[model samples]
Structure formats: structure tokens, C-alpha cells
Target: MSGPACVIRSDQAGICLFVRLTPKASRNAIGDVVANANGQMQLRVSVTAVPENGKANQVLIKLLAKAAKCPKSSVRIASGQTDRNKTLLIDGNPEELMAQISQLSGRTDT
Candidate 1:
């Protein structure tokens, strides 16, 4: 009941983001929010790290930290560590971090 947002949410701690990660993609980037088959919208993120040995998750966290304008250590996989769909918690000013994550969801430069 704490995480799992369609895009991002402001919490007492910081911000929560729902992400759908794609490993070994053409490139690493943050994409817009897209709806899945179940009609749940998730932010799209891609990394080049192979999905073996939890490397992809680490890459994702770094990328997200950069995109969210937060320190790398501020990002953490709150849930779905082994799954493409994950919840990343960013530790920072909730308002500022949410703005950054919103820019991610509203991206049109893909």
C-alpha cells in the first residue's frame, strides 16, 4: 500500500515510481508511461545491461537516479526486483522528485 504508482507519487519519505524495464534494448532511456494488457499504466525504462545476475536492476536504478535528479544511492527497488515491472523508491524532496518523474511520464522526445 506504500508504492506502485502509475507514474509517480509524493510520499512522506520521497517519491514512488512504477517502472516497466526492458533489458538489452537498442539504447538506455526513459520513456513515457504506457498501459499494459491489464490496463495498468507503467513508466517505460530501458537499459543495456543483461538481465543476468541482477545487473539490469542495478543499471535501471542508476539510470532512474540520474533521470530523477537524485543521487544513485537515493534510488532503490522497493519491490519486483527480479521482474521487469518494478517499483523504484527515490529518496529526496518529494515535490522536486515528483516533478522530475512527471517529466519522465510526459516525455515526447522518444
Candidate 2:
């Protein structure tokens, strides 16, 4: 996958992403990486759905699957399903996918 927030790891299975989600935002979009109070970086993502009944999570998965150029089934909520901070498992080539996502995260400094 990647590291430092937008992505947590790049492994043979897939990429692991830590996302700080904002539900019911004005629109659905993926923003930049931001540090939490603990100084841990996370990707800032917003969705229009309320964070109930896993709707927001579903939306996030759909969005991410599209963004990562993978099937929706390939994106899974590895953890933090009921919380704003979520972990995602994205299936595919980690190196290639991370490169694409790095651009989406606006990770020029990296």
C-alpha cells in the first residue's frame, strides 16, 4: 500500500489505509492527510451519508474502490467500522496502487 496516514502499509495481499472520515459533509470527496492529536497521519475523507447502518462505510468503500481502480468487493473495512477513523484493506498490486493513491493524497512532500 503506502504509509504515514493515507496508507498504513503496502504488502503482498493489498494496501492498508487509515482514513479519518467526515460523514454528512457537503459532498463526497477524499481530502489530504492530516495528523490526529496523537500525531498520527490519516487520510481526510468526507461522505454525504450519515454514519449509521454502515451507509457511510459503504459509500466510502465504493468511492475508494473507484479511486483505487478496483472492485467494490476488493475494498473492505478491516477495522473502525463504527468510528470516524477507519482502516481499509484494498486488494491489488500495492506498489502500483500506492503510487496512484499517493497522487490522490497530494503527497508531493513524500
Candidate 3:
């Protein structure tokens, strides 16, 4: 499979965000935009929660929801539930969500 095509993208369902999660981090926060070996961009996310029983995933959703100014219910993992890399689907206006994420990540490619 290919690396993440984009860090964030507008989707019919809302917005799709590619992220690399750092569980058991010192703190819960969103970092800068970064590229992988395949030159795919993804947001950096870190959380103090452990990577077990979906704890880290839950924290990730909450962190992103707050960053995007959206409700936690509006955010869900579209893929990579059991991996450090994840694709999140935030339910909202695609343009608005993309803009928010772009601002958050300091990347306007979206």
C-alpha cells in the first residue's frame, strides 16, 4: 500500500486526516506536519494514554475534536484503529474542517 496521500483532505463525509500517533507521551498535544519515507504528509499527535484497550485512540479523538472545535462524537477513526498511524474522519463541513486542520497543522496543501 501507499503512504498517506495527503495530511488532510476534504471528503464527502467531512474531512479525512492522516496522523501518526505517539502514545504514552509526556503530554497530549498536536505537533507539526511531517512526511514519511514515501513522502506522504501526516499530522503528528501525541497522547499520554497507553496504547491499549483503545485508550490512546479515545484520547486522540478528544484531542483532535478540541483542536478542530468539534464534538468528540463528530470524530471517528476511519482506519488503523490498532496501529500508530490512523485516518480520522471528522463529521462536519468539509471546507470548514479542512481549513481548521490546515491552520492547525500549518500546511495549506489541503
Q: State how far residue 99 of model 3 sits from its true place (Å).
A: 0.8
Question: What is model 3's C-alpha RMSD?
Answer: 2.8
- lDDT per residue (tens digit) for residues 1-110 in model 1: 22332567666889778889999998999887887777666899989999999999999988988877778999999999889888788898887787777777784321
RMSD, every candidate, angstroms: 3.8, 2.0, 2.8
Worst 10 residues of 3 by lDDT: 1-10
Least lDDT summed over 10 consecutive residues: which range in candidate 1?
1-10
How accurate locally is residue 43 in candidate 2, as Cα lDDT from 0 to 100?
Answer: 87
What are the per-residue Cα lDDT tens digits for candidate 3 across 1-110? 12356798777879889999999999998999888777878899999999999999999999999999999999999999999888899999988898898889887665
Choose 1 or 2, whichever is better by lDDT: 2
Instruction: Candidate 2: give the clashing pairs.
Output: 1-10
In model 2, where do residues sit more than 4 Å from their true spots? 1-6
lDDT of each: 0.81, 0.84, 0.89
Kindly list the per-residue Cα lDDT of model 2 for residues 1-110, writing each as its tens digit: 33453345776887888899999999999998898877777889999999899999999999888988899998999999899888888888877777777778987542
TM-score, every prediction: 0.87, 0.90, 0.92
TM-score of 2: 0.90
